[model samples]
Target: MNKLSRLLLTASSIAPVCLTLIFIGWMKDSRSLMIYSAITAFISWGLCWSLMQFAEYKLERSHKIIDSLSPANKEVTNYFLSYLFPLLGTDSIAEKKEYAIFFYLSLLFYICFSENYNFNPLLSLHGYKFYEAEDDTGVGFVLISKEVITDIRNKTFKVVKLTDYTYLHTTDRE
Candidate 1:
């Protein structure tokens, strides 16, 4: 993935938190914050759509047989909670807002530079599932799929490489 896509994916990984921040801004009657948060939410969604398009028309895809798989949805819980749970605490909006901006920017930079498997709930909401998977030769990567992989022993997936450590897995289920 490109730097822009990586940055967008990093932003989108916090999609739920963005929506909540918007609501909090409204609840707190801060018009400036509410408007800004709304804009951020909209842009985040646009980024997701663009990524989908890129994956469909741009990424080189191939079939791969995965021999070992384990669900990795729990990773999102930790990353998400770190961004969200703090909002529920006593910190003021200004403090959290600044911290979040700084944190997200830093995360975007890191993601753009590093090969990492990003577990995103927004992608989950879009019918994607995350898994820790390995091939017969023990090569490992995070698989993002649309189908619930029940049989973990061996499965052939249409894989789109998103990064060195990540793949977008597709299969006909319906």
Candidate 2:
């Protein structure tokens, strides 16, 4: 099944369990508004899980598309982004700030707020590895696992078109 379908299935299955837990105070032994709390928790968990899955699906798909595009298309993508984010534009600062905040929140939400079952590329690749996001260059810099990095360097996973940006894998502290 597709990623969205899998995510929806997982969420539908888990929502009930979470609702049940909230309804019965599974761990806290605290009294909840039972039906109301259960409903809220159900909605919250289900939507959150679905969104997590959606992001993972998008990221994976984006990587595949980026890896397959031609050099001309890469140039087009860069040109579009550059024009879209003109530095001297009146709202550029606001746009940049908004994107930064959104990115930071996504990082926090996916990394810290999510459970182990939630999908994350960073976690899947390597734990405790650092990564950098370069917007202007249209590349996500990552400190991937050694095995993955080796594969990348060996051309197993080709970056189809790297016009202006590419991740630099570094382990040196200094």
Candidate 3:
């Protein structure tokens, strides 16, 4: 994927935390913080949804032959939990707005620069399923598909490459 697209995926990855911050601000009666966080959360979610739709419709597809494929749904939680460390300090967020801002901005920079865009919750929430696939050479890849692939080992699939290590299945879309 391109840098900007990767950035969007990273932003969406933290959107759930932003939504949580919005709720916290609301419970604390911090209207300004609530509105601000709400705006950011919705924008991240909306843009992510748009980008996924664009990929499903406008991107070109090619076939990939894989020797093995299996469900990878559990991998999503590992990615999701990595963002919760700073949340420990968020209990006093109203008084620590600067710290919270710096914390999240730094998190965003780290994730983007690190290029960990494989397990986005937004992709799962948008009806995509994750799979671990390996080629005949034993090289591994992350594959995203809309359909539930119960048994498709040693099959060729129409897919679009999202990154050097990730692909999106192109068939069975509604």
Candidate 4:
């Protein structure tokens, strides 16, 4: 997903929880509602920010790895990769379409009914890890796992290494 979509998703998820917490605190005749709300908002914002940073890091890392792979390997890798916050279905229809919807609904359910509403949907989602190889350009290399290598070797996908710099300089240099 784009940065704006991720920010909106995070905000939509966090706002309700913060408001609920603040309301509960107020209902309980807390010593200071303003202070309570302020603290809650701060914590919520911090958590959302941290989550977004982590997601961005993962997405960037995954993209770099995917880009470094052979064309065939890249195709397979892209097929399986799912963004933490997907705006729309890119590849297959079987993939989850409404990540933000599920996240928000799950979050709302937890906030409204559960005692521990600190659940994070991002952490609950599954993710794959690709091996990293240090490179001079800082773009680095990606090493597919043994299983993936084996699959490629078995012609699950035609694996051919291309020497052309077709994807080179696609992104900003600095």
Q: Give me the candidate number with maximum TM-score.
A: 3
What is the Cα-based lDDT of residue 14 in candidate 1?
Answer: 61
User: lDDT per prediction?
Assistant: 0.68, 0.32, 0.73, 0.33
Find the 10 residues in a row with the least total lDDT in model 1: 82-91
| Stretches of model 3 off by over 4 angstroms after superposition | 79-86, 172-174
Candidate 1, superposed: residue stretches over 4 Å from native? 85-92, 95-100, 107-118, 152-154, 171-174
Local accuracy of candidate 2 as per-residue lDDT tens digits, 1-174: 234333332343233333333433433343432444466445645564544344433423223212221111122343233223322332332323344234323433442323212222222333322222333245433222222221222133212121122222223222
- TM-scores of the candidates in the order shown: 0.78, 0.23, 0.81, 0.25
Winner of 3 and 4 under lDDT:
3
Tens digit of per-residue lDDT, candidate 1, span 14-92: 6566666666666766566566667776788788767866785667778778888888866666676645643663247
Worst 10 residues of 3 by lDDT: 78-87
TM-score of 4: 0.25
TM-score ranking, best first: 3, 1, 4, 2
Q: Of models 2 and 3, which has the larger lDDT?
A: 3
lDDT of 2 at 97: 38
Error of 4 at 95 (Å): 46
Instruction: List runs of model 2 lying over 4 Å from the truth.
Output: 1-31, 56-60, 64-174
- lDDT score of residue 111 within candidate 1: 47
> Ten-residue segment with the worst summed lDDT in candidate 2?
64-73
